[model samples]
Target: MANVTAKDAMQIHGRNPQHLVEKIIRTRIYDSRYWKEDCFALTAESLIDKAVELNYCGGIYGGNIKPTPFMCLLLKMLQIQPDKEIIVEFIKNEDYKYIRLLGSLYLRLTASSQDCYKYLEPLYDDFRCIRVKNRSGSLVRGHVDEFIDDLLHEDRVCDVILPRVQKRYILEETGEIQPRVSAIDDLLEDDEDTEKESDDELATSTRDQ
Candidate 1:
């Protein structure tokens, strides 16, 4: 098999480097056999590291095509918080056709996961608009339903979301989601500790009050 570089991956979807990295990382981790071994196993950490590295490279290259707002939209699909500002910004700033293309691809790729469907369900109106305008076929729709069914069978949601939420909150406080240079293991540990501390604090505060 050919080694899939970030560029090659992006070319597959006509996406930008950063978006390709993000998608590759997410998909690889999702398919990893030992992802449950740790919060950031070697394979998982490598993906995050690669994404940051590629993001930097793309910025420095200057001539590189930026990841489409559609890619960001897919990333946002994994988020629980209502990122209305980001979504609105993408709609206003991006080409409608590209946005629809990206959305269609995202739905097709993630359609086997029930959790993804749950996240996307709220955006039904937006999805419908894309479907109608883009003429995305029934095949993509089938994939979407399949993903939803898969999620229903697993009866589980992504374990990474809460920690990501915390990470996002911390980044929001700092006014940017800086890609940290720490090892994946360390990052995962820090997130675990944060979770523990949060639970402890919640319990303590609840009892105290």
Candidate 2:
């Protein structure tokens, strides 16, 4: 294993020398896995690479596991361009949940194709919200105005539209929701009922028992 200092590790990965050294020192103190000099260096390099990739796409590193909304916006911006093959590749990866988040943002920010909008309508209904500011802080506008205006001739969309869309999608995806099965209490009640019925029948059969 190569003996690596925090400064050497950051230099090797072309990261911010000062920040990387600070991060390595912090991780060495808190994260037991980074206590080893070689392991710490390798982890730092990986973090730097991941951070660079995210920055290129417009994301901010949120600890080791997640990226922020700014990153999603960046990815959306990249997707609008004609030549970014790597961005396309990243969007195609299913494991990249951020890609879906970016797509949602793109749809909202840009006028997407009608076909794309229709395809995403259900998901949008599920995830998106409209807010209006009045004298009070904020209020949900819902999709009532748009759906009614577009689908019907109404001034606002129906309140039921989103719920209906979500219900349809759930039905299509998971079949119909089955009735919940009895738990122990219900089962015990059923058993007691059966016993009562049996006792009644025995009383009827035996005249003087």
Error of 1 at 117 (Å): 1.8
- Model 2, stretches more than 4 Å misplaced? 1-92, 122-209
The 10 consecutive residues of candidate 2 with the worst lDDT sum are 155-164
Q: What is the per-residue lDDT of model 1 for residues 1-209, given as tens digits with 9 covering 90 to 100?
A: 11223222322234332233345444543443323332222232232332232111000011222322223333433331123343333233233433323333334333322323334333322322221111221212223323223323333212111111122345446655443233456779999999999999999999999
- Root-mean-square deviation per candidate: 20.1, 19.0
Q: What tens-digit string does per-residue lDDT give for candidate 2 at 1-209? A: 22323332222124332222234333333343322321233342232234333311222222352323233223224222212233333333444434433333333222223322343343423323333222222233543223222322222121111111223344445654332233456779999999999999999889766
Worst 10 residues of 1 by lDDT: 53-62
Q: Which candidate tops TM-score? A: 2
